[model samples]
Target: MPAESQRLYERIAQKLANDISRGQYKIGQRLPSERELAQTFSVSRPTVREAIIALELDRLVEVRVGSGVYVTNTEPPGGKAGATDIGPFELLEARRSIEGEACALAATRIDDAQLAELNALLTEMRTENEKDVMLSEDADRRFHETIAAATQNSGMIAAVKMLWDARTRSPQSRSLSAKVRATGVKPRIDEHTAILKALRQRDPEGARAAMREHLTRVIDALLKATEVQELERARQQIAEQRKRYAASQ
Candidate 1:
């Protein structure tokens, strides 16, 4: 596909996904008419239809008989938001820019009530089970977004919201998350805890530094995983070629 098309779909899909998850369009709520979406997106009607169809494929929305599109039963896919395609490096870089600022602003303005909410989320997520760890990191994203709101910076709020959406929805995000949690990455957990502490203390700079460190650790881990995935892809390709050659012989 053309680069422009790729970019357009990526943006539109993310917006649609956000609307669904944020309940801008409630479950079973009919989406705006395709004509309306096309005007809203400032693109062709076919482009709007394609976008909607793509969303339906992901189970984010449904098309009902004689009614407009409706959000379906399924949760929107995480991390990439609705991005149809995004590579690991792009994702990590985006995370750095957004979370780095979110933590900074959060420190400046987070209230006791917000801290309590985060504490509750931390309890729900952080655990060392005998055999498994349940990493509810979207809870982590929600906390960050809430903090962005506390900063009362609209730009910060919007940017962090998008990054958080992508972070929570990407397939690679999910896979690496499960991998990291399963392997027991403890210091990273500590980093988040420390960031939370900084927020509780209302130290903006401290919160920023802690968030930066946390993201740095996550990026390093993701790069290693990306390398492994590259190797695996190469191996799979070679194996398939070998099978074909043997059959031809």
Candidate 2:
């Protein structure tokens, strides 16, 4: 694929793969910390994280959580690299742009029944979230799709569904989501409530802003969940050094 056409994470993955193949990162060696890689590539840490996941999928590296990523194989298995999957951050950005408009349109056309359904779903989301149930995500998906259906625009519905499908089906996105969820991040019920309140008020701009803000927070959560805490690692190392000094004394 052309460099311009590829996702930022994909481009980073290709460069890192090349570096590995060229012996710059030897087998079993730990790659640079995520912060260092982000700095070197001039990309965000989440983008670097997606690249690392891509490398893992290709069997070129393995992620050792709370430690670092390590090179496993210089060459991809069967001489074939993994398919370029959509990055999680890229997917969320697309949703923020497209779904914001979808929410605005829905605000004008949504009926009382649709609003009621959204309210019920909101309750469901809260219940499932309190139990830490994965079903909360199902309710979350339906909440957005119901808004699209309210738009009464088939194209809008399809577009929204396509984005949700990508989130469900893309390997890279799924991997990142799994990591994020493992950190106890759940859907934001308050944001969803804000969206529904705007829709009920028939305020298109309010609905748009609320939807955009919700997705923006989701993106922020993903960034934080995937962050490799270099400072924490530094503290651990310091503690180890202090123990060694005490033992010697």
Over the full model, what C-alpha lDDT does candidate 1 score relative to the true structure?
0.66
lDDT tens readout by residue for model 2, 4-46: 9998999999999999999999999989888889999999887
The TM-scores of all predictions, comma-separated, are: 0.51, 0.89
Candidate 2, poorest ten consecutive residues by summed lDDT: 226-235
Candidate 1 has which clashing residue pairs, if any? 78-168, 78-169, 78-170, 79-166, 79-167, 79-168, 79-169, 79-170, 80-170
Q: Point out where model 1 deviates above 4 Å.
A: 1-84, 128-135, 168-187, 225-249
Top candidate by TM-score: 2
lDDT of 2: 0.92
- Across residues 31-92, which tens digit of lDDT does each residue of candidate 1 receive? 77676777898975535544665576577876553345778844655533344644334566
Query: How far out, in Å, is residue 34 in model 2?
Result: 2.1
